[model samples]
Target: MATTLAQARSVLADAGAFGFPVDVSRRSDPVVGTRDSSRPEPFATLPRESAAIAGEVLAGELRSSTKSDGSGEYEAMQLLRRPVARATAAATLGAIDDDARNEVADAALDWVDALGPVIAAPAPPYRWSRARRQEDAARKSLEGRIEALGDPTPARTATMLAAGTQVPIAAGAWLLVALAERPELQERLAAGEVEPIWVVWEVLRLTPPTWATARVARRSLDLAGVRIPEGGVVVVSPLLLGRLPNLVPGGDGNPHQQLARLEVERWRDPHVRPGAWLPFGLGASACPGRSVGLAQLVALTKWATSASLHLAATPSTDQTRGIFPRPARIAVVRVEGGNT
Candidate 1:
């Protein structure tokens, strides 16, 4: 395990020396989502127009949810389900009809759900097991939806949509939870006292959806002072790195206590650069749709700040599928000026 930030950075930076321990040849084409024999990067950085579309979709979803629900109560994960899925789908499925995009979005959600058991299993399930079959079915369904849109790389597109959707959904929920928990901070953001991006960074620092990632050493090598044999897995935890005093603001208050708190103002200082902890992994394997994800979060933060929201129930941590706020129930106390 990469215990220090430097070690983690080294492990991630040298993608050649370290790789994910997966047999690409054994994986199904739809799940692998490679372009061809060479397996070039299938997911690209989202274009600005696509990012804007994602932001619009997210904002509209939040507004619709708030207006349609009489009680003003929302389960963060469930509420964000369609919005994040559809937002990512709309962004990635270029120039598709609204209905086709929506279908792809729903299919992506189903695929993600189906993937839960496969990912959570301690070891890969049997190929013919119910979980694997269901997952395969869901993936094929998503791929088919993309194919219907005449997308040349339907499998790749479906994989991209699913991969992009899940993380942002959790991140968006944490953003809402953070805002709801600190009304003062929310007010400051709404009043434009603080930049929304800082809040997004803070949420990502504290509760990054992909809190930890693993890389396997392709060859026996020294990592920091430690030596490892071939295929040794090195895990990097962003959650741990985010709390380091050097990476984030913690000197003002007790360093230990302050680092853990959600302090958006901490980012006001121009010197301390954000994302030092690598909320999104670094190097060639870094998240491809990070731009769209950030746009979605910032947009959500803006919409959240416009309204008064309070936690209906305390959120519990769920590490099964990355760290996220489960049962993140919130009550919209009041709607303010307008949506962002």
Candidate 2:
């Protein structure tokens, strides 16, 4: 694995020399050909209008379900799922009618769900296995929906929607969990004493959804002084690189005292770059939805600051599909104007 930030960047930056571990030539999916050519990346800058719409959707959903059980508690994953899906879909399928956008969103979510088991399995299941068959059905359903929306690249669109939807859902949940555990930090955020973006950055650094990524060497090369033969695999871990002292401020001590600790102010230093750890990967293949995803998390943090939320139960890390907070239950104890 590339342990240092410099080494990680070196590997990721050499996109021509390194390629994804998967052998796409053997894949049956024709859409893979268009992935690199997909146009108008979803919410590349997350315009204000789209951001406002997403914020409204999130706020409306959370408000309606805030105290449904009189205990003010709700499952984080379930609570944010549809809203994230819809918001991402709207941003992805720009100018599309609401009905069509919603349909695509739901289909993308179904594809993501069906994809989870297949990804989490210990080994690739047989092509004719139930898991494979179900995943294939989900993919076709999503692709069909995207195609119906009139996207020139339906397969690429389907892939983008599914990828964008799932990661933000997990990232947003983690942001809320972090805020809930730190009332003082929330208060700081509420008072505008802290940057919401900083909080989001810290959470991403600590628990990035795509913690590690692999690259296969296209030819023999020297990486950070280590010789790697052609076809050799190298892993770059953002989670580990985020711990390096040079990359993150206040990470000069022990692991727990460093990036492991959620100190948002550590980013206050002007010279230290926020994303040097490359939480979203690097180079041409870096996450295309980063801006939209970051906007979603920042908006969530802003909303969270206006309300007091507490954890109803201890959430655990789920490694099934990237890292996520499983059973992330939180109680909406109070809103800005009144108790929930």
Candidate 3:
């Protein structure tokens, strides 16, 4: 419930103190919830290979979107879904052909949509409930596709798509939203006066899609002066911690003002680390596709800066779908005589 960064960091570091939210053992009875130990493969250790694959895929998609006619009103979030999904799908699926890779990409988005309601509902739905049923169907479809490609564990593949493809779509949407609003930053980005990586970091700091993550105590433990018995849950919010002035630099004014104001300059100082707020997270379960996701986003920033996209209307937040823009629609047109 608290937003203390150090305590959150401590819990994430100590695997003995806490385990993942769904790491419990499976119950035999149908009345009980299911357990999942299928963690996605981390891409941090495979930088060179991942960068080449995801970068090429992502760049090509962006180029395609800007083709035929660049002047069109588009829903920014909807526009990003396919490209991001394809990039992530390609990166994770290894040497799959283009057609098979596209099939998996569509399935990933469908599966993520099926999961939305289940995660947002107050309580868990029954196995036969609509949300659960839809989730199962989509999960099966995705898994079946992966199985068709000679992959044994489609379940892990589904998990990878859910975390890697879907979440990054939301994050990329937020990045576009930030760019649409911040004309000053956009100008700097357009002129190549500032680093595109900072735009990604600034957007993440402002509105991290996976705002909060949870961990449950394996046994009795105390955190930040609170004593909890066994099986207690602890929630760490990167969104809240990101607003902390102490963690990120460049907040000479009041706390609220500093946080509300986007500070791309925060990372300009070499002494201050970019990940003190843990946007992707820390320790072992800290998103295996983080580096891959960043590479995609960086390519996105490069494309966005080169294009001209204006927010059609003030984008509304859709908290039901894990903090995404409600109608992430925008007007995208080429900045004539500029880099198309």
Indicate which candidate wins on lDDT.
1
Q: In model 3, which range of ten residues has the least summed lDDT? A: 24-33
Per-candidate local distance difference test: 0.81, 0.78, 0.77
Give stretches of model 3 more than 4 Å off. 23-46, 338-340
What's the distance in Å from true for residue 175, model 2?
1.0
Backbone clash count for every predicted candidate, in the order shown: 0, 0, 1
TM-scores of all models? 0.91, 0.88, 0.91
> How much does each candidate deviate from the true structure in C-alpha RMSD?
3.4, 4.0, 3.3
Number of clashes in model 3? 1
C-alpha lDDT of residue 229 in model 3 = 62
Clashing pairs in 2: none
Q: Flag regions of model 2 displaced more than 4 Å.
A: 23-57, 64-71, 252-256, 336-340
Tens-place lDDT per residue, model 3, 166-215, is 78889899888888877788789888787888878888888888888777
Tens digits of lDDT, candidate 2, 60-124:
65555556432467788887888788888877778888788878888888889988878777766
lDDT of 3 at 337: 62
Among residues 3 or more apart in sequence or in different chains, the pairs in candidate 1 whose N, CA or C atoms overlap within 3 Å are none
Whole-model lDDT for model 1 versus the true structure? Answer: 0.81
